[model samples]
Target: MIYADNAATTKISDKAFEKMLPFLQEQYGNASSQYSLGIKAKRAVEQARKQVAEAIGAQPAEITFTSGGSEANNWVLQGVTKLFKGEDIHIITSSIEHHSVLNVCRALETENIKVTYLQVNKNGLVLVDDVISAVKPNTKFVSIMLANNEIGTIQPIAEIGKYLHGKGILFHTDAVQAVGHIPVDINKLHVDFLSASAHKFNGAKGTGFLYKSASVDLPNLVFGGKQEHGYRAGTENVAGIVAAGYAIEENVKEMRKTAERLQAMVQTTVSEIRERIPDVWINGNAELRLPGTVNLGFNGVSGESLMNILDLKGVCVSTSSACNSGNDEPSHVLLALGVSEEQAKSAIRISYGKYNTIEEAEYVASAICDAYSKIKSAI
Candidate 1:
């Protein structure tokens, strides 16, 4: 099968799996326990923490393990708001953010926190100028995704970070889709908080981390035993955490080469598909997108229908975020980019991974074109 839905989730790498296996077997011990077995688990978790921190150019103390990106996003958004309770604080976030961030903002609004849902351009980019203009004196925080999950457009984070730095507003980025795929540095991004998921980068699922700048302080999202340095409290997912570290380390080592290869495959597929389907248009700034990800709008076609047809042919793709898989609503991300509902509904995302080959890319292009032609003829 040609799996083009890396944006949704990736298959766990062999190396990561290998690193995780022992913890699930004989190494089963709670990280918080005081015994030698537990001490070993604790050491493993700490080593994972360091690996994650090093990957993002953060201090080990800054990384807090979480269930996944959603939790990390929730903690940062809600936890930070708790710090300024009863104050007129505003948050600036782009409308194209994953529902994790957008929904949390909505929840905050019920508590009377002001949130400015910043608009993006047609290319799905959050302009730094728009962010600057939206900031109020009461704007205490800004939450934006480093890269969009649907269109894979990288945001102008560094520039926005530079501006927010001068204003002393705390910034958080949901870097779930960007971390292992591209270079990420806490210092470079100048973010106070960052969220990432291991599954997006070929590590085990149900494992992720949050990077909290040493200078920032936020309330606890979970209340339980002392875990995550009293910031996030719960028993750690030892095996998943170990895998995450090894997977991230391995991916970073081979990132440049893998990205180059995937980009070539993506280009080949897009070119071939577009050659046969003239109305096909990419949804974001094509030049500034993730290396192997593309959201294509096929005029006069139902994205769901195309996705189902592709599935039947063993070419896996997605109509939108996997989180909203069953929801019939038009994509919020596309709507935020000013796309008509009809156009938004007609989009499909293709995300290639390091495992995909050029041959599979060519096959997927032919399959898509053939399916499109068949669907068009039926009309």
Candidate 2:
């Protein structure tokens, strides 16, 4: 099968699975326990923490393990905002953020916390000046995705983070889509917090980490035992995390080469698909997109139907975010870009992984052409 839905999730890598195998069997010990096995598990967790942190240019102490990126994003949004619970506070976020970030912001709004939903351009690009204008006196934080998941629009995180530096307002980024695809340096971005998921790259699912600046402080989201340095309390997933660290490390090591290959595949896929389907339009910023993602709007075609057709033919793609799957609603990301509901409904997301080949890309392009034609003819 040709899997083009890398944005949704990825298969585990050989290196990751190899590193994780022992922990699942012989090393089955609670990291919090005091026995020799437990001590070994704890050490493994710490080593994983250091590996994840080093990959992002963060200190091991500043990184906290979570179930995934969603948890990390939710915890940061709620935890940081809780610090100003009684005060008149505001948050700055874009309308195009993933539901994890968007839902957290919406939840904050219900609590009477002011939230500024920054608008994006037709390319799903949030301008830096718009962010500047949205800042309020009580604006406590800014949460933006480093790269959009649905459309692959790479935001100006560094620019926004630099502008917010020393302004007494914390900055956070949901970097789940960009973490393994690109180089990420917290110091360079000047971000106070960042979220990333291991599954987005090739690590085990249900494993991710949050980067919290040393100067930033917030209450624990999960409280019971002293885990994650009293920041998040839970028995660490020793195996999943060991796999995550090794996976991320391996991904980072090969990112430059893999990214190049993915980009070439994207170029070829887009060119061939658009050539075959003349009315198709590429979504998001053309120059500032992720290396391997392509969100396409097949005019006069149903993305859902197209996805089903592709699936039946041993190819996999997405209509939008996996979280919003089965909802059949227009993508918020597309809507934020001012796309018509009809066009948004026609959008299909295709993301390539390092393992995907140009031959597979050509096959996907051909399948898309067949699916779009067949679907349109029936309509």
Candidate 1 lDDT: 0.93
TM-score of each: 0.99, 0.98
lDDT of 2 by residue, 101-147 (tens): 88988888899988999999999999999999998888889998999
- Tens-digit per-residue lDDT, 8-115, candidate 1: 999999999998999999999999999999999999999999999999999999999999999999999989998998889899998899889999999999989999
Candidate 1: 10-residue stretch with minimal lDDT = 216-225
Candidate 2's C-alpha runs over 4 A off are: none
Residue 292 lDDT (model 2):
93
Candidate 2: count of backbone clashes, pairs at least 3 residues apart or interchain: 0
Count backbone overlaps in model 1.
0
In Å, residue 167's CA in model 2 sits off its true spot by 1.3
Q: Where does the lowest 10-residue lDDT sum fall in candidate 2? A: 273-282
